[model samples]
Target chain A: MMVDQFVAQIRRLGHGVIDAVMRLGFAARFFMALILASGTGLRRFSLVVREIYFAGFMSLIIISVSGLFVGMVLGLQGYNTLQRFGSESALGVLVALSLLRELGPVVAALLFASRAGTAMTAEIGLMKSTEQLVAMDMMAVNPLARVIAPKFWAGVLSMPLLAAIFSAVGIFGGYLIGVRFIGVDAGTFWSQMQAQVSVRTDILYGVYKSFVFGVVVTAIALFEGFDAPATAEGVSRATTRTVVISSLAILVLDFVLTAFMLGGN
Target chain B: MERSTYDLWVGLFVVAGLVALLALAFKAGNLGASSIGSSYVVKANFDDVGGLKVRAPVKASGVVVGRVTSIRFDPVRYQAQVTMKIGDAYRFPRDTTASILTSGLLGDQYVGLDAGGDSVMLKNGDTIHLTQSAIVIEKLIGQFLFNKASGGGKSPSSSTAKAGGL
Candidate 1:
């Protein structure tokens, strides 16, 4: 009986692996469909604009607020630590580098995944459950072109910009705490940051990271929703999966990108 | 929301993002004051460069005049060859001395140029003579430790004089 149970468990595990691989393959094909159908989506630019408004503008308040708080915390913590080493002036360098290189892209993407990504999954999943996608197919209207491609493009366009805004606000918050409140030399703070941070390496790399995250997060969210079972429970589960899977993907991609970008120097 | 309203908001969002990117580039990065344009390159050789890295600011009397463009090791001379690009806005004499200096005790290293009294300005491709290598802190500390261990039996004043020579 024990041997039989062990064999059954092994089979179950293999089944799970196969299921995941099949889902991943399906997602890839869906992504390729999105790209191919993007021409039609772009032709009706209003759809993309509406999606951008929802995905980008709607999330701005939370991103800015969280960015400010994160920066203020970084400033406070960095000041206390750097003061011990008598390098309080270098606080600007620390704050800017951390925010621009790591925190901005990663945190903003995480926020985007939770807020915008979940909404994308839920909306699409609901439409799928209601047979809207099938209805569109019956009418010879491709939902991939009409619905999914627009959302995907909006995500790809908005993420880097959102991440930029987050970093910029975070830097201001750091300046407020470090220079204005803590009395670190204002000149040294700005000058040192400018001197240390290269536009190409630090800022451009951050933008590139966000762009990749946008594509990944949007793809996963849409894929989960589109592939979700036609039930309320399935849509809800897919929404949750969008958040969990995208967050994990963001972090793993961040590590790989950072190593690839900075390992040379 | 109406279609027009969506378009307006999207427009505003894109503009805001662009503005933020510009602020980051100008304020927090070296975009506004980058001196890589129309620059003249000069080479300097050092026995040791320590922590001096490529793209480090090359300052003349505390003002940044150029950047270190490249650092290469010369197997022939067993020295580090540093190429610096100086902005054409500033001119330094041919006899200028390039010495690597640190900002604070633990700060990043930079090349300091002390212009010598020379009538001729340094042109592109000129090798700067009288270059001082970066002070390796480990060697200094090790020497100090070695001095103390060796001179433990001698008078303390003698060791003090020897240490001062460094």
Candidate 2:
């Protein structure tokens, strides 16, 4: 009896650990399939194109508006510091560089997570809980391709455009702060950035980071939904976990991607 | 719910808009590449160049006019020959000076130019008569450390006594 009890305790712990991991794997797979399915089954150029338009381009206004304020804050801080060295004119570099490489993608991803990400998780969770998944099955619908496809495709396709809008708005925001609030010359602000501001890598990294972020977020949201518990209680935990996990994952992944791209070569 | 054709046009516009935006960005980025500059050869007699690479920005009035196109040892002069590219707009007179400048607190280094009054402007392939070689921060820091070891820990601010007024 003692030996049996000991074995049971170890087995229970192992099962608990495996269950947590399975939940995570399910989420990752769900996101990946969304991307894969776009290219594979639901592969209408027009449809994917439409999905991209709605997902990526439509989200531009929200991202840019948020990004502009971020730029303003960076400019305010950068100006104070750069003023000490008499490099105030180069506030463009400070604002532009920070906005393009770091602030734009991370901030937009967080906002997108809040706006669409939570809703996606909940929708998926509700569907799974009510077994609407079974009704789709009986109707000969591919659940992965139909409903999940739109969200997944939207997240992946929308990122780069959102990032670009974010960067443009952010720089403009910085310009406002630099010119009106502080007395940096508008010409000097622009020329300084023009002189030392740009590189292909900066733009490339922004676009690339956005694409990766889109994949990660959709996957997390879908995973939580499909993996929802049979009971109302289980579904609640899944939704909460989706938000917490995805937001944190985006931040961590952003840093890792930044380091690899900038620091590697 | 049935969606109409008008909803589809909005989708088309979004894709077109993003493509246009990306193209514009790539075009602007090309304007700032290091390769955009004029070429001028400058023979600097450095015992060591301290790893100055080719295509590095050469500046005048903090504006990049050219780059270091080549760096080779002139065995004949026993000095490092650094060929620089100054932009066409910048006419370096016969006695113009060249030195490697650190752009900021960071080690982002570039070459600087100071024009001197000379009747003749330098043509391509003419080596700059006056040249101040690269200043490595590591060497400067090492010198400071050596000074500290010998003189017993004076604050570094004392060394900047000669560098008066911003």
lDDT of 2 by residue, A1-265 (tens): 9999999999999999998898668766766666666554356444555545545555656776788888899889999998888788778878877876787778888776765676677888888778887789789977777667766777676666666677777887888899888989987677556545445567667778877887887678777777778668877787787778889999999989988997864
Interface RMSD, every prediction, one decimal place: 0.7, 4.3
Which stretches of candidate 2 lie above 4 Å from their native place?
A1-13, A28-36, A40-42, A49-54, A129-132, A230-237, B1-56, B60-63, B67-97, B102-109, B113-130, B135-166
For model 1, residues B1-166, the per-residue Cα lDDT tens digits are: 7999999999999999999999999999999768457889999999999999888999998898999989999999999999999999889898999999888777789999999999999999999989999878777677667867887654544543454331
Instruction: For residues B1-166, write the lDDT of model 2, one tens digit per residue.
Output: 1244524654664554475345425432334455554445555455456656665667788666777767889999888878776667778787888776565444345667899999998887776767776666677788888888898667564544333122
Give the C-alpha lDDT of model 1.
Answer: 0.93
- Cα displacement (Å) at residue A71, model 2: 0.9
True contacts kept of 1: 0.84
Which candidate number has the best TM-score?
Answer: 1
Candidate 2: residue B139 lDDT (0-100) = 72
lDDT per prediction? 0.93, 0.70
Model 2, chain B only, scores a TM-score of 0.65
A196, model 2: CA deviation in Å? 3.5
The number of the candidate with the highest lDDT is 1
Chain A TM-scores, per candidate, are 0.98, 0.85
